[model samples]
Target: MRLSEFSVPDTLAARGALALAEQYQSEAITAHALRSWVWAEAFALVDGITGIDHELLYVAAVLHDIGTVTEFDNHTLSYEHAGGHVAIALAAGAGWESERRERALEVIVRHNWPRVDPAIDAEGYLLEIATGLDISGARPDALPREFVRDVLDAYPRGALAAEFGACVVDQAERKPDTAARRLVDGGVLEKLAANPLEAR
Candidate 1:
């Protein structure tokens, strides 16, 4: 399915999450978050992934990179875990039950790790794939031609590559013992301008 077939969640929690992201993050980050959601939905359609709670997935997608924002940055743990806590707080404020909030937290934290298992946690897996596809140039061939054109037309990669690369590199430099540092050390953001999954 195309991105046009999907709709963002309209709940207060969803709206607040987006608003909070916009309030704290740069334009590039906000755009990347939205694009990640579209990519997740696109992959789910193409790969036949199922049994997802779209609203919860929406929350996870939008807030996945929140730790990159200055306000959420925690020096001790990886940014993934820090952002997961921020998401959990938002979920709690929204009156999410204990179980649902925990699951959402799991999805948020898992996005930082590689090799997500869809069978065990579909939202996390899809979010991980989608974020990787958008930020690291992973699996561009999985997207349909028309779909790629449509998503870029809507979100516009613009300066996201440069912006995101800087964010990752900065995090790695500031927080030495974190996953972002590992990704940087491994050259994940070395090709700054070349990594984003643009339409061919």
Candidate 2:
């Protein structure tokens, strides 16, 4: 399988987000974040999607699941909203301008949306496709089969299905109006478990 061609952003924002995710997120979550970035980048290339801000996508991808972390997780906010807020503060600390910081917030929050308008936010569209693919194995044809396997080999799923599912389940129970609740009501846990990626 000797797959070593993959790489990720090393810019200040990318590096800062990576560090933040490492420090606050669990092993499964950190892996999910990394995989999300890889998948997002792949989608950009394969789909010929352009006008992407690599740093922004990298930052959003790495921190998309931030709210699932204990430090950022809260009782009132949906994880996506909490994660968006966390990204805003973290991006500010990383010296991102107000507009860029707000964009990051939008990208993070919109990643959980049913669909993102690519014309409006390329980063959000990519993140949604990538995260949806990574966590639930939706739209399996978006990427080549071998490439998917290689990416999985490099970043194993470990307990992501269990850990992330539990987090959403918690969110559903506490914040019934959020997307997390809808996902739970829709049997997200079972979907995660049955995700074809698990067999990769």
Which parts of model 1 are misplaced by more than 4 Å? 196-200
lDDT of 1 by residue, 41-104 (tens): 8899888998889988999889888988788988786778888888889989999998998888
lDDT against the true structure, each candidate: 0.84, 0.86
TM-score of decoy 2:
0.94
Q: Which ten residues in a row have the lowest lDDT in candidate 2?
A: 1-10
Clashing pairs in 2: none
Count of steric clashes across candidates, in order: 0, 0
Name the TM-score of candidate 1: 0.94
Q: Residue by residue across 64-179, what tens digits does model 2's lDDT show? A: 98997788888888888888888888788889899999998899999989899888889999999999888778888878888888888888999999999988888888889999
Q: What is the TM-score of each candidate against the true structure?
A: 0.94, 0.94
For model 1, the local distance difference test gives 0.84
